[model samples]
Target: MATSPTPALPLPADRPLLGIAFMLAAGLLFTLLDTGVKWLTQSYSPVQIVWARYTGHMLVLGAYLLMLGWPRCRAIMTSVESLPGQFLRGLLLLGASTFAFLAFRELPLLQVYVINFSTPLLVTLLAIPLLKERVTLARGLAVATGFVGVIIAIGPVDWRAQPAALLPFGMAFCFSLYQLATRRFGRNDHPLASLFYAGLAGALASSIIVPFFWSPIAMGDIPLFLVVGTLGAASQLGLIMAMRCAPASLVSPFLYLQIVWATISGYLVFGDVPLIETYLGAVLIVGAGIYLATRRG
Candidate 1:
């Protein structure tokens, strides 16, 4: 049986709850992929892991498109001439992934994830200047609350603060830019086609880095690397389907699930249990995100 063709998306109203659930699921998969990348660092270089992820993501996505008669992939290549912002978004996304992969090597998985969740806060802050988006009082307060949670997640910044922890923060900031650019440029390009190119961009960028920073891949690490790629594709496709079903505001909050997913994965895989402050911070960030999402104007 053929899957029902997705109904055209209307603005901010249709099936909001369902879309949010889909986004939540996507976030869960994404963080699982993140955890796998984190684990691989014990035996593989971050660049190698990143390359593997791209390799897997491309193969999976390519296979999907091939199944669909190579719809979006063809369009992405033919239409690249007209899509500068998507290219820029891809470049920033690649940078963000690089930073994130490096951070995974340096920091605990839970800390890295919670810190990246601070992207929404950075998005709020950047909108005033980059997108000229008007800021509301609720969102301002929420951004503040979110940052407080981030600091809590980071623990006290001491002399022993790992220099590598900054990479995730940088990833958050750059990924926030990628989000903004997605909105700015997605007007002309289909989202999936744009994403295909973005994945290609990531793969190409890693080609250079994987040389100097490359390590020999162990057979043990291949499965996790495959998971990272396959799950990343699934998560992106899920997210795209979700946006078509419901408004972004409804689904956006679920991105925070990365923190939850990371927390659970860390506990099970690495014996890293959450501290009291971590839970407290999660509550504050979630509450603030809820407020910000629900606020009107």
Candidate 2:
């Protein structure tokens, strides 16, 4: 006997608890993935880590689509015009991940996460120009408040003293571009198709440079590579499941939990504790984000 196809997504009201669980799982998986990336820097090149991440993501997604059968596979192929957009989105994501990885090499996990949280603010701002979105006064205030939090997190004007401090900000900018592209494509393609393009594009981008940075993986480190790759795909799937189960507003706030996870992990793994200013800024950033995610238009 053949297995029945998967059921349609349940309404958010029907499964709020499950949605919250999925979001929590996604956050934990993502934080663990980042921790693994930071750990692997001790031995592997950033290029190699990035390559493994995208390659594994693509492979896992492909296998999933295959299991879902032909219609889903066709959905992922998308249209010819969308190809360039997908490729650009992939490049932006690659840049975002690569820069964050580089920042992790120098910065503590808490600091990197604090800066990375600014992507929502940047995304709202970028949408005005790129997506022709109208910014409500409330949204604008939230965005402004978020930037203030970012400044506090960044500390003094002399932050250029630690140039690497800027990498996570750069990562946030690139990630916003990637999200914009995803928004553009959302109008025309399936989410899985867009995800397929992201994984494909990211893998291709890193594959170009991975050759130069390649090292034979020690037997001991193979599991690390596998963990990073699996977590990348699993975390993405978890986020998708979360949104499928509940409204984005409900699921998104859970993402802020990453800061707590990052803080704890950073202290335990790296013996790095964040400054009081970092905590203050994080509260503001998270508060602003919660407002943005839940506020009426």
Candidate 3:
């Protein structure tokens, strides 16, 4: 009876956990970015908000290129076999960002998140036709279950009454397309190069359209515009680092934690609470996603 207290168990030495931590942090940052989009949308059109975000992202990427010195910067900026894929990927992402911003303007954050979580499932399905990847029975079942989850999340869409509800789904599809394009370009281009083009495409495209909808920004709101860009770029960096540290399968599941951050932010900042059905749908979607992630190909 003289043995003092039982020794505490030692923590496991796991590098993947570090990747997961990074993924979680990235998720929180993404939620913050979305919150900024929602706030700024109150004052500006979705196009303006998107332009500000793309401008910030492009500036950050430009600064990164500058820090890399002339040779490396030129290397990343130079076109290669993947240039077309990179441009397409960038345009796809621009569409995704525009749709997401539009969705945030109308729906609550949690609702948008729940609907947007279908991107992974969409990617899995698209891989069959676009990438010629075979889906096993289990993965197929998971995809089917994911669709059911989406229907549940959407809770009956009426085109005339709730058209904005479709924006998140469109965002998911555009992002899936971007990911597919990435799969092709990933084999040829350096990751940073592809990233640079994405920023460039968005900035260039939005810069052209943003002028039509632009209104002078109030001095008070300038900081928010800056936050929108800075936070968006930072979140993407965190995601890239997380994926670099661990396999996509290991790091990807942690992205579900984003809904938690969005839920909290929506409640605190906007005083918006999701209906119980939304939570039910999110559980289904996340459960299916976990199945797909952990399933052996």
**Candidate 1 — number of clashing residue pairs?**
0
Worst 10 residues of 3 by lDDT: 1-10
The superposed Cα distance between candidate 1 and the true structure at residue 187, in angstroms, equals 4.5
> For model 3, how does the per-residue alpha-carbon lDDT over 210-253 read when each residue is reduced to its tens digit?
98999999999999999989876778767765665566677777
Model 3: lDDT to the true structure: 0.79
Instruction: Give the lowest summed-lDDT range of ten residues in model 1.
Output: 1-10
Angstrom error of the Cα, residue 173, model 3: value is 0.7
Deviation in Å, model 3, residue 234 alpha carbon: 1.2
Writing each residue's lDDT as its tens digit, candidate 2 over 15-101 gives: 888988988898898889989999998788888999999998988888888898897577557543478877887798888889988
- Listed per model in order, the count of residue pairs whose N, CA or C atoms clash below 3 Å is 0, 0, 0
Off-target runs (Cα >4 Å) in candidate 2 are 1-14, 70-72, 75-81
Q: lDDT tens string, model 1, 1-297?
A: 000111223445588887877777778777778778888887778788888877777899888778766555576556643466667877887878888888888777877766766776787788799988898887788899888987776676663556786887888888888777766765445556765877887888888788988766678767777888888677776776677768666676667667667777888988887778777776776676666665765
TM-score between model 1 and native: 0.88
Candidate 2, residue 41: the lDDT equals: 84
- Candidate 1 vs candidate 3: the TM-score winner is 3
Candidate 3 residue 293 Cα shift, in angstroms, is: 1.8
Cα misplacement distance, residue 19 of candidate 3 (Å): 2.1
